[model samples]
Target: MNTTHLTLDEKRTLDYLESVKTRLSQLQESIHFFLRSINPETTPGTVAWTELHSKFNVLIAKYLHLTNILNDPRIAFNPRNYTVFPFEPPANDQQVQNLSVLLRTKLFPELEQADEERIKEGTIPGLPALPPSPAPNRAVNPAGVNTPVGTADEKKQWNAYKLKVMMHDELCRKADGIFEQQRDMVHTKVRYESDDGDEEDD
Candidate 1:
């Protein structure tokens, strides 16, 4: 077994990665459980069923991204000599379904509850809602033009790429907002004038 010690920063990164791994496993297991309890034939096109698959696809895509980050070689670190190591990422294209048909096998009740709550309260102000995902194998371009008749793979890739871009842009926007808010905060300095008016006391 090849063992190596992690530096303080690397150890923190590893801890977070481990947590993400656990969450991904739990998420997949929950999805499997939900899938096992559903009747796809009976529930086709139903709101609950459609929504369940939609939510699962989104969550799984997010997990795939997290795993990708964890497996990134550029970020790998070792405590010894503070050196980096090259880590080969596992192949996971099969894990992210090229089509949504696979997700129809599940019903995510937790997601259903969350969706209801979100609908009642509404999303955050000033944030754009996610692009409305279309059914699997079907995608519309921003120009309102339909994809060429038989480019399923291209359509899927385009949608996935677009989704990632949107997610990242939203995150960056939130971060920028946080920085701006901090800058906008009114800061008051309490000053005491010493016996000598010439000297300013901080």
Candidate 2:
């Protein structure tokens, strides 16, 4: 894609998405640290739980808003085809996935509920259908395994290219090895046959 020709709106969208990703990472890190610091022996009271829950809800709302914005089909990264902008991988894959799960399970339904309320109130013009909400992850993984973050499809494409190259190299090496082995076998058989013929002649 010709990333150089990106429009102002596209650039702004990308920037906004990047900022959201950064904030999500920070929020996840904070939550993890807080959970780690707490002791199970001193069980969290209702008030403490409520406070944590509220904070989590706020984070999830923001995450869902940003994620939905990014998920707009118009903004997706495409190589040499759809998008004029290049895709970049986000720093925090685990955080993104966790945020995605939180959005899908809790935040998305809440948003839909809000949208229904808006429609009832006659605030928004039309009920623009959102992308189908995904199912939540049963358990989130810890930071940084191989889980893809922002522009995951782009990463997949790049990975596919790399895999193809690796496979080609492997096949070439294997073919060369096999050819050498066949050549050696043929040479050995020929030499043995020649010697046997010579012995017979003698």
Top candidate, metric lDDT: 2
Question: What would the TM-scores of all predictions be?
Answer: 0.26, 0.27
What's the lDDT for residue 113 in model 2?
61
lDDT for each of the candidates? 0.44, 0.47
Off by over 4 Å in 2: 1-17, 33-47, 78-202
Tens-digit per-residue lDDT, 39-112, candidate 2? 45233433376766776776677667656665666755421121111112233556345322222233345655
* Candidate 1 lDDT over residue span 28-111, tens digit each: 656654564464532344447676787677667767776676566676532221111111121255623422222221245565
Quote model 2's TM-score. Answer: 0.27
> lDDT of candidate 1?
0.44
What alpha-carbon RMSD in Å does predicted model 1 have with respect to the real structure? 27.3
